[model samples]
Structures are given as C-alpha cells and as structure tokens.
Target: MTRISRRHFVVAASAAVACAAARPARAADTVRIGYIGDFNGASLAAVATDQGLWAAQGLQPDLKVFTNGPIQIQAFGSGSLDFGYVGPGALWLPASGRAKVIAINDLGQADRVIAQAGIRTMTELKGKKVGVPEGTSGDMLLRLALRKQGMSVNDVELIRMDPSTVVAAFASGQIDAAGIWYPLVSVIKERAPDMVELAKNADFFPEIAFPTAFVSRNDVADDRSLKVIAVLKKANAFRAANLDASIAVTSKFIGVAADKLATEAANSKFLTTAELEASAADGTAAGWLSTLNAMFKDFGRLPDPLDPKAYFRADLYQAG
Candidate 1:
C-alpha cells in the first residue's frame, strides 16, 4: 500500500573455543545478506534463490530486505549487513567507512523527475514544489539534473520524502514534481497516467554513470563472501537461458509484472566475474567510483568526502 522503512562476530581463544565446543552453533553462524526489495536490484536475490545458487554455495542467507538505501545505510553503519546490491551511491559507504564495492548491477532508468500532467520540462518546474527521497539515487540524480540544466534547488520549492511517500504526496496534490525510483516510478505511471517524466536519469549522462552496484563489508576475498558472489555470478550466467522464468520470479518479488520487468531487464546490462575483476584491475571501476564520490559531495549529498582508494580492498585494487 505505502512505502516505509544488520551484525556478525567471531572470536578465537583457547578457553573461548572450549566454551563454544560445549554448545551447538547459534544464529550468529548464519549469513545475513541485506538487499533492498526494490526492483532495481532484486534480481540478484531472486535468481540466487530461484536457481538454488546460494544453496549450492552452502549459504543460507537471511536475505534482509530494505525499502531504500537510506534505510540500508543505517544497517551498514551498525555492521549488520555483509552485502548489498544498491544504487550508485554505494560509493558513499566505502569511501567513508568499512564497505567495499564488488560489481555493478545496472544503469538506472527510472531515477527521474516526474511531474504532474501540466509540467513538461525542468524549466517549467521553477518555483514549483518538488520532492526527493533524501540520500537516495533519485535524490542524487535530481541534484545533478538540476545542476546540468543551469538551475538549482533554490529555483524550486524542494520537498524531501521517501520514494513511496513521494508518490502518495504526488497523488494527494501535495507536490508538483518528485525525484523517484521504482516500483514507485511504476506506481506513479499507473496511478497518474497523464504524468510526465520531465527528465530521465540518463539525461544527466556523461557527468555521471549512475551505476547500481554490489557492495560489501566483506568483499570477494573472504571465503564465505566469495562463495556468495560465485553463486550470484552463476545466476548471472544463467539469466539468459532462464530469462522468462527469471522475470516471472523477480516480478513476484518486486510486486510488478513480468512484462514491466522484462522491459527493465532489456535496458540493463550485467558483467561476468571475469569481466568485473578485469574492470577493477584495469582502473575502470576505480575511476568511476572516484568521479561519482566527488560528484555526490559537490551535490551536497556527502558533506565531507573521503578518498576513493579506501572504498575497496587493497588486494582487488578496485579503488586505484
């Protein structure tokens, strides 16, 4: 109906080991992989579960589902999540904290400025009330789009809300335009058939790549994490052969239909394990992360940015 709203421990000691031997393994032994239930990256888990890849990898993932990045960011801060497939802003975590990026998920299309029927373009949005889900992908893109247009948030009445609430506000005539993501993006289209998407995420091109990616506190080097990534990569390899069935499973997960997801899947691209590893080794991934980190800081999303090099592990050299 409406939209809304992770940890691990290990100890090794001679005496502590004897204590552990006295009891069976507890819940802490299980893997907790956090994921946003949003369609943007839901396929990772859907394919993993549907194809039994995670099981094959010997991981029974908790599969924590969140509404958006802002919510997941808290989990990261608390060290509750081991991995996440999130929007481009994943750089924010690694650059500033203990996270590291693994691979790119997709280039977003629905992160855009949607306005009421009468509004046709960004220029028309001047002096109108527009909403953005703070610290999310849509918010980041909206800021960049405005900057590119030679306009600023000062030119409009900026309202901040979550993606789901943005749709509700839009439906209630509380805001004229909003920076939103799916299924809210799809929800808006369905509920307001005449609505106009004034600017798509792709419009602010060249300046930012807007890559949704897989990020982790424990990267591929960790044996447990590596198993999970291997499973995910297996799912990626099988995606083509199982396209229709994959979409059917993902559709139910994202609460959208197979046709809609099929369209989104067409617009997205994936990288194999070898391809992603090569990108990191060659500096392609690092360069993009560096640029996007600086971009978010410039946009006021990140007040104090950290070095991009710290975002990835030294072994992978992805932050080079």
Candidate 2:
C-alpha cells in the first residue's frame, strides 16, 4: 500500500465532502405542484423552479405537467401533487365531488378555439367538428362562443379530446377545428397556415376566463401556504421583468423556439399581484364565477350557481 501525502489526502477528502454535499436533499419544505393549460405562463412557474425561487422562499415543488385540468386535479386528489393549476370546471370537480380549492392563480387569458384552414369565423363552424377537452374551461369557452354568436353546440360537431391530442386530430383531418391553447395551437398554425384562426381568447368571448391555481389537501394551507403565495408573487414579478428570457426558457421546456413561444406569450395576459388580488376580489374573476356558475348550471356541471366569494380563498392574498 502506498502512503498518501498530506496534499493528496486533503484533496481527496475535499472531493468526498463535495460529492456528499451534491447529493439531493430530502427537502422538508417541498411543495409539489400539478400544472396544466397555458404551459406558456406555466413556464413562469418553471422559471421559479429553475431559479430556485421556491427553495429561496423555503419551499420546494415537484412540478408535474398535464394537458388538461381535470386530470391534474385528479392527481391532486390522489396525493400525487400538493398543488395544481386548473380552470373553472376544476372547481366543479372539488365542489361536485371531493377535491378542494385553496387559491386562485390567474384568469382572463387562456387558450381558444380556432377555426383552421380557410375557416372564416365561428359561424362557419356549422356542420364542422370542433374539438375541445371535454368539460374544461376550453370547452366552456367554446360553448360560450357559440352561444354568443346565436349558435349552439348543435350547430357544430363536438369532438371531445384532450388538448394534447387535438394537434394530431387537426393534422389527421379528423377534426375541422380545435380549441387548444398554445404553444401547441401555435405549432399547429405554423405547420398549417391554411388553417385559419377564426377565434382567439381576445375575440371569441368577452372576458371569459380560466384559473391557474394552487390546490392541495385542506390542511396544507394551514401552515406554510403563505410561503407558497409569496413565491408565486416573486414568480409573477420575475415573469414581468423577464418576458423575453422567460419565453426563451419556456421554448426549451416546450421544445419550441424563442420567437414562437413569444407569440403565445403575447396572446396571454400576465397579471400583476395587485391585479390578481383585485380580479380575485371584485373584478373579472368575481364576474366570471357568476358567469361560470350560470353556464355550469345550464350544462349540469354544477348543481346550481355557486357564490363567487365561495369559489376562492381571499385569505391567501391576506396571508401573502
């Protein structure tokens, strides 16, 4: 056996210690997040993850992504996630079933149903198969768009599919149009320019909105929920400050380029913390809840219209 010199021993010991330090820690403050829809802005959440903002705030989230709301909400109910982002219908899931709503994330901007391929407008969709994730905000918004134009779901063929699957349906010509959000929708448009964009979030419905939320077991919010809220606030600030960089980072995660990601980001409305609060309190969210309840009531998604105040937790804003 060779005797190690003092310098060699010191270097070897340092290396061993460094390697041990590099091992993943069992984060005591982990906050697992289940996300879906507008994976564009969810990229902001990704920024928070990559930058360790969650860790800096003494929280860690195991982030999982899905293409629709109800499925992610299922993960939240089944203990796979501690928090989730969902649309209005997700409220019905917990309200109508067994999950719970902790806080409202954002609203007013979600994906839209675009009539592709020389399709001129919503009315042009008559006799055409319009695709949407069944029983989601996208679906609700699509229905509302039809109703607003004095048309009904009967006027068009309804193709119930996951948002992820819509791209393929559109490509295969199985569906005349799709109600999808970006960056998938944007990708479809790029591949098929003949696919006309008949409606977008801004044009289809007047201020119809969805939710990106933080949902968990009822007790998770009892202790460290405020910390989660603060981290989201920091995330919103970071997203506001670094829109371009955020888009580029998102492009990598979504497998798209920076410019294409920017296009989707442009279609979205990024809310400030104060805007989030006001909307949650007395603005679009309040109005949308009333609207959502009425629509759900008609669609049988809800037993009846729920109170707007009952749908959100104002306490989270206060806690933040």
Candidate 3:
C-alpha cells in the first residue's frame, strides 16, 4: 500500500476549494451543485459531472467543491448553490429548515476508532490522547464508542485535530488513538501498519445510521431537484459497476491519485435508487435523520429539537 502524505491531501483539498470559490460566472440556466471534496458520497457529483450525466439529462451543472459541509451550507444561504451533498454532521441544517433533503445518498461505514496495538479495548483508552475532528461524525462515533464502554469524552484526553492532522499525529505517535474516517483511515494504515481498530460505525448499525444526504434549497424547482436526483441515481449505478473508472473520474476532479482513492472507494457502499426509495418508504431514512437531530442536540451543536420530516421530501422521489 502506498502512503498518501498529509501535506499532499491538505494541499489538494485546499486547491480544490480555492478553485471552486474562484469559479467563473455561471450561465442563467446553470444548476449549482455544492459538495464536500474527497468524500465518497459527495464525490458522486464529480462522477456525474465528469461522465457528462448531468449534460445528458439536458441540465447544465456548475459544480462547487467544499472541504466540509458547514462551508457548503454557507453557499446555500447565499443562494450560490441550488443543491448540496452533505455528511451527517450537517443534517441539522436541513432538518432545521435551511434546506430540504431530496435524497439519502449513502450510509457511512468508514468511520472508526483506531488505536495502537497495545490498546486492545475501549476501556484501555482511558486517559489516553485520542485525536478527533470536533463536531464531526467522527466525534459522534468517538463519544458513542466511549459511552458503550460506560465511559464518556471526559474519560479520554481528547486532542482536537482535522482529519488530515489526525492521520499525521497518529502516524507519528503523537496520539495514542484516533476517531477518524476513511480514506484517511486507509492513509493511516499505510503509514502505521500495526495500528488496531477498536470500533467502527457498523458496530452500532440498525440502531444508528450515519448517512450523507442530497439537499436542495426550498425555492428550487421540484423538477430541477428531481433531475439532480436522477443524475445521481445514474452515477450510483455507474460507480457500482465501474469502480476503477469512477475512481479515475473522482481522482481527477479532486486532485488525488486513483490508487490512493481505490481503498476509500472500496470501503464505501452507496444506496441504489430503489434502496434509497425503500429506506424512505420504510421510515428507515426518517429514523436516521431523527438520530442525527437528537445527536446534535445532545452534543450542543443544535439549540432545539427539530422534526426530521420538515426537511425530508420523500414525496419528490415518489413523484419522479
């Protein structure tokens, strides 16, 4: 396995964000799509754009890549974006009525609590330095993992760091454990092959779901929003069938090497069109959103309880 340096990932992500910020003026008919770069679920927009799926549907897309969901939400506020693909951390924004969730892209399975070989269980991490990106899905996972062991964030010496920095700090022995997600998890394993996994998102599945979502502003036309979802459905099938090709497209779009992205790509499992609709119809999607809403409030990231149904527009999918 080849190691993807922290500096390389940071520089690439920064450059991509800069380019998106400096993008040229869009045409009147352009559909601005904002997404988090280097993320598997959000990268589907890149796949659709590079493969000309949006154009094939007679839609003109103005793609903007951000480093995270909060920043992308700012674009939505400014009316700069018509749609967005965001992680679970930003689910509150939609549930709170900032935007409407048009689709559930995928459930997250790559987040984990990785520890050194000597630390075999979550109990062993007591008082040990654990690196995590605060207010992220990784942070939520870390707290949940701790709670499962009858512990809390207070029991660990929490070291706040971005995902890329978490990789570097963990690889250098600066941190004893990490609450992080893949592609970066893969990077850390490449650098420190002896690292051990203490817990993962899948460990609490069915009870908890960390899903990425596609959202549209309340003012966007229903037809246009449905078209975006249609393009994503096509992109999902294309990605599932042509993994290498999809990786190549995303690699070029994000400035990451295809080989480095391969592991991350393999770790992801996107929901198909039928699966997405089923999750919505069966109340699985609502349950996931409700979980996020409650988690955010518990973490003090949200001020009040918001109904997940307020932002979830499952009717649009049924109409399409």
List TM-score per model, in order.
0.82, 0.81, 0.81
TM-score of 2: 0.81
Off by over 4 Å in 2: 1-27, 37-41, 88-91, 94-103, 108-110, 204-207, 281-284
lDDT by residue (tens digit), candidate 2, 186-271 = 77776676777655567644645565565555546556767777777777777777888777666666566777667667766677
Worst 10 residues of 3 by lDDT: 34-43
In TM-score terms, candidate 3 sits at: 0.81
Off by over 4 Å in 1: 1-29, 218-221, 313-320
Poorly placed runs, candidate 3 (over 4 Å): 1-28
Q: Which pairs of residues collide in candidate 2?
A: 31-60, 116-196, 117-194, 117-195, 117-196
List per-prediction Cα lDDT, in the order shown. 0.70, 0.69, 0.81
Which candidate has the top score in lDDT?
3
lDDT of 3 by residue, 1-320 (tens): 23568778888999999999999856445798887666575568877877788877678888887755666677888988888877777787886778899888788877789998789999999999999987666788898899899898899999987777898999999999988888778789989999999998889886888898888888999888888878887887777677788888888888877776776665556777778888878888889898888877876678785687778988886555
Native RMSD of candidate 3 (Å)? 14.9
lDDT of 3: 0.81
